[model samples]
Target: MLSPESAEIVRATLPVVGASLDTITTRFYTSMFTERPDLLDGLFNRGNQANGEQRRALAGSIAGFAKALLDHPEERPDRLLSRIAHKHTAVGVTDDQYVIVHKYLFGAIADVLGEAATPDVIAAWDEVYWLMGGALIALEARIYAQVGADDGRTWRQWRVVERREETPDVVSFLLRPIGDDPVPPARPGQYVSVRVRMPDGVHQLRQYSLSGTGEEGLRRITVKRVRGGEGAPEGEVSTLLYDTVRPGDELTLSAPFGDVVLEDGDAPLVFASAGIGCTPITAMLEHLVATGSRRRVLLLHADTSPADHALRQDMERLADALPAAERIFWYEADAPQGARTGRMDLTGVQIPRNAVAYMCGPLPFMRDVRGRLRAAGVAARDIHYEVFGPDLWLGEDS
Candidate 1:
């Protein structure tokens, strides 16, 4: 809770601070990285930084947290905080790092705000920062404890046992622990962070969903090589994983962490995806088949074409394994015979009355599907979504 004095100060300055958050965060990252280059080695995502997604996400989160505090003084933004905590824990963020962030962030705030950042204003914002930071630190500690991870020793060696090409651009890697320690258990929709040293001597990391049954002893992750166009640079880690890493190669990976997992229920389920977004949805289906779920499941997907769809065979096999599952597909290319030919349309599709829908895909695709689902009488809360990168879908009321 904020003190009355501080609350008034924050409420007064939020407009200005929010307006300048982009500049503040950009300056924060630039100056912080200039001094602490080690953070870029394996901790921070260099690609997200170069593309400005990280900056936007950081700015949005700070502004969002502040707005939530002012809007609901008695409540905390657990949803926003929990999502961030999971991502931070996945990358082995430690408590001390928060202090470093505070120093640089406040300096950037002062730099951007100029003389308006008076002592009282600075202190009020400082309190807000610590409130958020403390909450994240506490949540992250609990998550680390839940996952049984050492404070800073989160990385483990995994050897690739098999690599299969799912599509021309997507591949799946099967990995086994290099040591005798058993692989940690993970939920169906969780993801693991894979860290690798690029040719330039910088260590880079990327998160790939656990695309198979989250079983013990082995793990599988699907990677889609990102070929950049229209000003976006090629994904460094993904390109390396595609062209260099192979069976018998050793890689470093973090323990699984993601909030969007298959919940225990008998309610009907709607699993939807587009392009490579099918990874987590595939995992969810694999879990359902493993458990012999008799619940009605609607499996929907969209892609450029059958030839471009990753894990197409796996999807069909899993859907067939479920006695009550219905599979639907949409392709950009001409529909072959009975299949639909255009983008995903749920216009005539019959969704279960009480189904819980989970979707992962491009932001635009997810937004469109979400609107249609809501119009079809599905509660907004019942429709869950996951974005692959920095959540550009930040301001949406999802």
Candidate 2:
């Protein structure tokens, strides 16, 4: 809980700080990168930086955390913190980096706020920052311990045993550990970070959801080549993986770490996804099939077309194997025999009663589906989602 004096200051200054977060975050990234360019080489995603997504996400998170503290003084935002901590652990973020971030972040704040950033103001916000940071540090420490990554050595070499083309733009890699180190236990809906050296010799990191069962010994990640359009730059790591790194090549992978894992329950499951977001959903389905789950499953997906769907066959085959599973797909063009045409519309679709839904896709798509699911009587707490990149929708529901 925040101290009384600090809370009053934060409450009074939140509006100003929140409004300028974008500028502050931008300045923070610029100044930090100017001094510590090495952070961009391996830790930060240069593509996200170039596109401004990382800056925006940081701004949103800061503003959101402050608002949550002020709005609910009695409780900490564990959900928000857990989401961020998982992502940080996936990228091998250590406790020391929080201090580095604090220095640059506060520097940017002071630089932007100018005269208004008094010592009292800075100290209050500093308390807020450390409160958020401390919670994250503790959560990440527990996660690291659970994954046996407490030593900060999160990366491991894995040999690609098989590479298969899933779609025109997507490929799947079946990987096995290169050493005798036991594979860390993975849960359905979790993801692993893939760190690869770019052509320039600087390593870049990207997270890909496990597209197969979470069983030990082997793992699979499906990659979709991110075609840069609409002012976005092409994904360097994805493009590199797509063009090169064939079977027999070794790639560095982190232990699977994600907060949005499949929950064990007997409730009906609703798995909804679009494009490459289907990876983790497919992994969950594989787990259910492997365990012979008899729970009712409703799988909904949307894509440009059946040809563009990365795991179309796998989805169909898995759903078919399940005794009580139904599959519905939407395509923008070339609707198949039983699938619907046009964008995803759940207006008349029958959502199973008491269904727990999991979604992974673009933000707008997820937001729309979430609203419809709520209208269809699924509780807010029952809806789960995963974003492939930095979470721009951090506090949307809250």
Candidate 3:
């Protein structure tokens, strides 16, 4: 916990860091990798660094922590720290390295603020950082302890068990935990990080949500390699996971974690997903059906081409399985082979007027989908979306 005065300093300083995020993040990572080369192996994506989303994520986390601690002091930080811990876990971040991040970030604050950053202000930020970092440190400590508990044999080494081409660019990796020990169960709609050595690009980290129900005997993730721009390659991690990473290869990973899910409600539930954004949504449906929920459900998905559609056969299975749930698929390709042709049309797709909308996708796609949902007269409180990156594409300023 931080003093209110210290929290105020943090609230004000976060705006500074948020505005000039790239500088702080560049300094932060530069310090981290230069000081500790091991992190470069699988904790970052140089290609994704060009857009500076990761940097923004770091900045946002700091800002959010200050706001949450000040706004909700009695709150335990699990709801806040667990998400970041999962992300860090995906990238193999340890508690020691988290401390290193704090050292450089505070140093960056001094450098960037120069004379304006007083000792009191610095002290304030120190409190804020620790409150947030301590939350993450504690969470990571528990996760690592869980990993270490069973003689270091539990979940220590992960091997690729099966790989399937779900869509053209999107591939699903079915990973089976192999060891003398047992594999712990993972919830649906959570993600795991995969590590690969990229010669063209630096060693990178990317996350994919489990594409199917967990009891399927293997954990799966669907990946769509963003290309052309500065984000990801045509293959990116996909090329590495598909071509380079063979079965029986060892990859370190964090346990499954995410809070994004179907909330309890009698009102109609609307799930909207675009591109490869369907991964978690798909899992939600599987979980929903497996649990025998009778709530009215609507699934709306958008994709560029038929080749890029995810889980066509399984979606068909879900459609048949869930009597109250109806799925809507929209393809943007010219030759279109689905129910709806072209991009997601908020005009054409009629969501229940009172339905709670859960959405996910690329930034532009989300912007349009949200705009359309609003245009279609959906209430603001009902529209929920998650931006895959660090960027805030949700309520308020978004």
Candidate 4:
């Protein structure tokens, strides 16, 4: 809980701080990375930084945490914190990093605010920062312990056993643990961070969803070669894996860490995905099939074309194995016989009542589909979503 005095101060200055968060965060990253260049080598994604998504995500989180503290003074925002904690643990973030971050972050805050950043104001926001940071540290510690990564070690060596091309731009790598260390159990819909040394001799990390169940000492991850468009640079780690990684090659992988997991229940399940977002959903479907689940399942997907959809055959095969499953797909071109044409439209589709939905895809597609699902009577709380990269959807109004 925030101290009463700090709460009053935060409530008063939230508007100013919120309004200037982008500037404050940009300055924070600029100054921090200038001094701590080592952080960029493996800890932070340069692509996210170059495209400004990382800064935006940081701004959103800080503002959101502050707002939540003021709105719900009696409770901490565990949901928000949990999501962040999982991501932090995935990247092997440690407790001491918070202090390093605090130094530059508050420095930026003070620099940006100038005379407006009085001691009382700084103290108040400091309380907010530590409150958020402390909660995350505690949550991350618990997660590390649960995953048997309490030794402050998150990465393990895994050798690629097989590689299969799923689409023109997508490939799947099946990996097996290379050491005697027990592989941490991965729940369906979880992801692992793959760390690779770039040609520049600096290590970079990217998280890919476990596309297949990690069973029998094997795990699978699907990678899509991200083509640069607009102003964003192409994905460095993905392209490297897609073009070079093959059988018998070893890769560094983090223990599975993700907040979105397939809930275990017999209730109706709705899995919606688009393009490469099908990875996690595919894992969940595989789990369901492996467990011989008889629950009603509805799989909805969208893609540019049938050939462009990764794991298209796997999705069809898994759905076919389920007794009460229906698959619907939409393509902009080359729609299959049973699939729909153009973009996904749920106008005439039947959605089971009291269904729990899991969605992954582009923000626009998820937003539109989420609205349709809400209109079809699925509760907002039942509609869980996973974003592939920096979750810009965090503080957005649903």
lDDT by residue for model 4 over 1-398, one digit each (tens)? 89999999999999999888899999999999999999998899999998899999899989889988998889888878888999899998999999999999999999999998999999999999999999999999999998998734889999999999999999999999997878889999999999999999999889999999555779999999998888767888899999999999999999999999999897899999999999999999999999999999999999999999999999999999999999999999999799899988999889998999999999999999999999999999899899988888786534
lDDT values, one for every candidate: 0.89, 0.92, 0.68, 0.92
The CA lDDT at 348 in model 2 is: 85
The estimated TM-scores of all candidates read 0.97, 0.98, 0.82, 0.98
Per-candidate RMSD vs. true structure? 1.4, 1.1, 3.8, 1.1
- 140: Cα error in model 2, Å: 0.5
Error of 2 at 211 (Å): 0.4
Per-residue lDDT for 18 in model 1? 92
Query: What total of clashing residue pairs does each candidate reach?
Result: 0, 0, 0, 0
State in Å the error of residue 178, model 1. Answer: 1.5
Q: Write the per-residue lDDT of candidate 2 for residues 65-96, one digit (tens) a residue.
A: 98888889899999999999999998888999
lDDT of 1 by residue, 1-398 (tens): 88889999999999999999999999999999999999999899999999999999888888888888888899998878887888898888999999999999999999999999999999999999999999999999988888788775678999898999998899999988888875668898999999898899998888999999434578899999999999999988898899988999999999899888899898899988999999999999999999899989999999999989999899999999999999999999956665688999999998889789999999889988988888878888788787787876654354
3 versus 4: better lDDT goes to: 4
